[model samples]
Target: MVSISRRTFVTATVAALAAPARGARAQEGSPRAGGRLSFVIQPEPTTLVCFNTTEGPAIQASTKVVEGLLTYDFELNPKPQLATAWSVSEDGLQYRFELRRNVKWHDGQPFRAADVVYSIGLLKSAHPRGRTTFANLLEAGAVDEHTVVLKLSKPAPYLLYALAAGESPIVPRHIYDGKGDPLQNPNNRAPIGTGPFVFKEWVLGNYVGYVRNPNYWDSPKPYLDALLVRVIPDGAARAVAFETGELDLGGSTPVSPLDLERFRSLPHLGQETRGYEYSPTLYGLEFNLDHPILKSPQVRKAIAHAVDPAVVLNVAWYGLGERTVSIVSPTLKRFYNAKVPTYSYDPKAAAKLLDEAGFPLRGRWRFALTHDFQPFGENFKRSGEALKSALAAVGIDVTVRGQDFPSYLKRVYTDRDYDFTFHPFTNMFDPTVGLQRFFTSDNYRKGVAFTNASHYSNPEVDQLFAQIAVESDATRRRALIDRFQEVVADELPVLPLMLSKPVTVYNRRVVGHTIDSAGVQGNFAEVWLRG
Candidate 1:
């Protein structure tokens, strides 16, 4: 990883001094259970269950109280959770799971094969990413009381990584059975599950509290007596809390970038970047293809050339991230294509392209458009200002605007009120599950928060994703991904900005938090304090 100082960005490899080895406790002493753990989640989660939403906070909160069929190690190999053992047929069409016995829900009901069957069915139809994640699923049937079989129409190579608790949580069949619109069900707000923690109370706009489940399937685990998630929206306040040692743990870079080095230097604090491999982030400029002016590829490509990613890295982001050329994250070395077309920073060429595209300078400006930045953090707002400044130099007048999270969602996805916006998306464990949703035609569902916000569609891109999804051969799949990147880069539906390296900050007193690939998003079934 690269280290950045306030004065300059230096290319250096530095091991996280505060972090412990992966899959191990922080200190050498045995863990002691009984203290309460307090953490922070920004912008308050809309629901406690993340089956229908992919908000990072909701996923982190839900996974503690909900479980999935399988877990994964640091190498991403499947590990035991609800499903103890599993096997796939030679044809790659059938998967059989051996359920862990003696596991009971928090409400005292025995977990059975029906829950897996029901949950997958809902996921394929309801979950935003699951629609594509489980598209090949032909049937989810129960072989017996403790066995379940999933038959697929074609191979899904990335299916294993998609079963982690955060992405695809298993819900109780009884409580949601025959319920009208699972999205609107009350269970989402107050979830009932078979995880290590139990939902206790949610004092709206303040905090959500949970008590350790005494009957948790994994006994003698979840050593903490209780878990408290405080809703601290401001980045400065979060940094202050960390300085005071009032917060125990927080993930996804909870504090501002300016405060990162301060926390890293503190003796009582530690920061880790290991656990987010399963969910790498991509920040980009999304263009509304339906708009009259942006529909031209020349204009989109010109805008891409006008902005400088170096300034984006050093000035706007404070060198917190790395620039990316393709929609797929560079962290995924196997499929990332470094040879794809790149748009370098060139203002003269941008003006020439606009002039050739028939939009000559009208007085002092070519055209004017409104811009919206993602309201999740302060960096994106600075990025908006940077974009406005950059475009103004190319004779394009830009009006930067800001809104709350809810209003931003409604205006962009549902109302289509803006021309272009700064957006961030999780490319997840694979390109098929994460990258496919942004360009495919079928995923352009109106009112959906994260799927195909740009309304960009191409039949060839869709075909490439379909082929990549079912292609079992590694060599052939890589070829298809390369072609997909070439087309998407040429079309320029969404300008690839930079790939983010998110950090998880925690007190040295915390242990067993970053033991898995999911990191803090894991169920925390075995997490405990060092005391």
Candidate 2:
């Protein structure tokens, strides 16, 4: 256990720790035309809540309509979008982004740095990722109509990647409307943008359609005359549609690994199978540190010991997941402290640890676990049942609960009313953004009151995380990360379980697609129809 930095456990479960502050691949291809590509995706995202948004889908849809300062290339490299190029201040406290001349908002207004500056102003000071990314430039300033400078209060290393996500999606300044509820902005229903597509029509419950931008800065691009996004929640229904040619692309409903061969084996669907490259996303059980029974390190360790992540890989996950040692995955290989304990199957050890922790037997403690319903969407349903049996052998009692994804997220994540739940997180290109959401106190799970679920707080760990965030040198920062991991192991904070192998399905009619580790970003600019 010495490998465990023995620090005050993350000091908290994660939702409140100071982070290394946050943190590319490229795919290239030619544009093609004359084909319609569509794929099935689990209906997840809907509104741009800004501070409280929880997904990537709607943003993905919105991005096509709203251009950002810096965009990603096929390999995930930072390329200029609205901002053609930029430079940084010598002190590393300010960043200047120069807008691409002649760009315009979908509404026909000339694109300007003032819009960028205004959009960033909406980022709540409490938003962890936003605050951390812009930590250097505590705020933004307009140098001119086209040039905006971001001045930092410190040297934040992960700022660029943070800007890459929610922080940089430029919103219409007028659309925000200064209302208290930005999510209800009229813009969300038919938002404007400066991309290849313009606001066409949004038919709630059916589809959102966008027509090609006639005034697009770049002509001969976005070959599709129109783009349509249909909302179909059923995975099978979506897949059937993709198989028939109802869509030019599918964004949800992952292709199962088992059916990969069979699905691809069928004609006209192989090309549609693809996903964002593997990034640092993780899915595992979140312990309610508030639970009296789970408070002991032995209990957390026992639960980790009892669950067989390998069985999860082979069964529910279909051998599609990579077992995780620390919370950090291989996509985030650098932050990983390999010295942490690995996942192991030891029912006997699990029971022993619980017994030592004062539980008379497995069934001794009663508990509840919950998740949104989606045909075993949590992936750990059966595995969790198996653990129930194993824990019963030692005297712990358990119950599993199911709710719709929306309600589950609202209660568990937004409201913090959950006891424990099956939490599966999508990967992010930036470690700071992804991990910070889970660890920062500003975030909550469930609909009840919010508290840092881990009940973990340590002044020393917090201090270290602060230093890690601002440290400009690579070597010192990494060393601090190692220290963070050790602290997690000691606290047994959020037990690291398993990482899943991503499965993507596509149609053969599609071409010029590349997947990067961020899980789904790459070559969008170069993706052309090949039918």
Candidate 3:
């Protein structure tokens, strides 16, 4: 999306996009260790555990308390967190991790290799991404108290990059072992992990507070005495809080894009476009194929013609988006196929297609449908409004609906109530880990939040994804990925709108906030205050 090639893509893109905000490093002083660091989380999280859902707000809050087996450096290479060291077999079937000892859960229980084994099992069954990321795993066995080996049925090329805390968090086994559903476990709201921060309290519709863990294995880090994850649903209020110095940090373009330039003008503030490489995103419209009216390919293509990607990029994203037509995000240069079929905005062509599909206009209206926007941010709401306007011109009466994050998930993934919804999804480090879940036939779980809500199933697409997962050869993998994108583009399950280059706005008093690629989703161990 930022004109990054495979050579300088993952971490190198940071410097490529860092030209505008060179002052991001202007604050130079000894790191202070005792002030509270407050940040913002929009549309408060439904749960604080990333083991079940891939909800953005939940991952941002939970990673501060819960950690994974490994964390990544700025260059997207694996580094130690809970696991001190790791090795892989020559055949690429077995992965052995040497766990860090003397690490204890927040509840004062010892963190053992059994926790890693248990958490891996839970993620395989529960986590939306893990369901595919760990599908090749045969078992996670504890060799000793500090060693756990992952035996896979086949080689997974992207397994190492998929273990970041936000993607696959390691939950405490003692707290979740015999617990009643992991998804319904009370610990989800109040989690227990061995990270540098300890969960303190969560006041619904208000804030979730965390204090420094003095007993953290990574000692003297997470220099803040306390951390506050403030939940301010109003964008204007968030902007005011930042300007007045009430809020210290915010990520994923927390405020409206219109206010980004004004925030940059404030000498006390700085903006960052780095550290989001771990979670490059794509925003678009996803449809429910189960709906009878949408069951026809002609109808789906007609609706696609009525939509405009440029409108979504300008009106909804405020020119902060790169228009894309492929289901896979262009930021992932290795697998993104630019030659995929694209839909052009043509109202005349849309009307003809709808008429041929047995939806002749009746008194100036061909049909009516409900549109839902992902409630995490305001940008999606604006995109839905734009879609309503475009579809109306083609004789389609549309009603845009608004709801909270949890309710939106239940309606779209479980109830399958809507005709189509506009939202954004993170196409993580690899397509097999992120893009496969949206198109693969096996990933169409009804109750899952981020799975295939579209229920799009193609035998050829499924087989191509299966082959791409285990194929380690560079040339062969690219060819397989190209075919997968071509088939999915022709099916038109979802209309790709744009790719996001999200910015993180923070106060100059905050230091080391962009030290890693995960951005705010990363643990704040290295983040310290300049005061």
lDDT of 1 by residue, 474-494 (tens): 789999999999998999999
Q: For candidate 2, lDDT tens digit of each residue in 214-238?
A: 7888666566666666677665666
Question: RMSD to the native, candidate 2?
Answer: 8.1
Please report the TM-score between candidate 1 and the true structure.
0.89
What are the RMSD figures for all models against the true structure?
7.6, 8.1, 5.5
Report the alpha-carbon TM-score of model 2 versus the true structure.
Answer: 0.82
The C-alpha stretches of model 1 lying farther than 4 A from their native spots are 1-23, 26-28, 178-186, 360-363
Tens digit of lDDT per residue, candidate 3, span 1-531? 122122321222222333221254344555678899999988789999888887789999999999988776555666667876676666667778878889999989999999999999999999877767998999999999999999999988788788889988999999988877888898998888898899999999999999999999877777889999999999999999999999999988889888997887799999988888777888877889998888888888998899988888898888887988787877677778999987799989999999999999899898999998877577888888899999999999989999998999999999999899986767888889878888889889898778889999999988998899987666999999999888877878887888898888999888878777788898888778875
How does each model score on lDDT?
A: 0.85, 0.58, 0.84
Residue 99 alpha-carbon offset, candidate 3, angstroms:
2.4
Q: Which model, 1 or 3, shows the larger TM-score?
A: 1
TM-score of each: 0.89, 0.82, 0.84
Model 3 residue pairs with clashes: none
Once superposed on the true structure, which residue ranges of model 2 sit more than 4 Å away at CA?
A: 1-30, 48-52, 73-76, 124-129, 165-167, 174-182, 255-261, 271-279, 360-380, 393-395, 404-419, 425-427, 440-451, 515-523
Model 1, residue pairs in steric clash: none
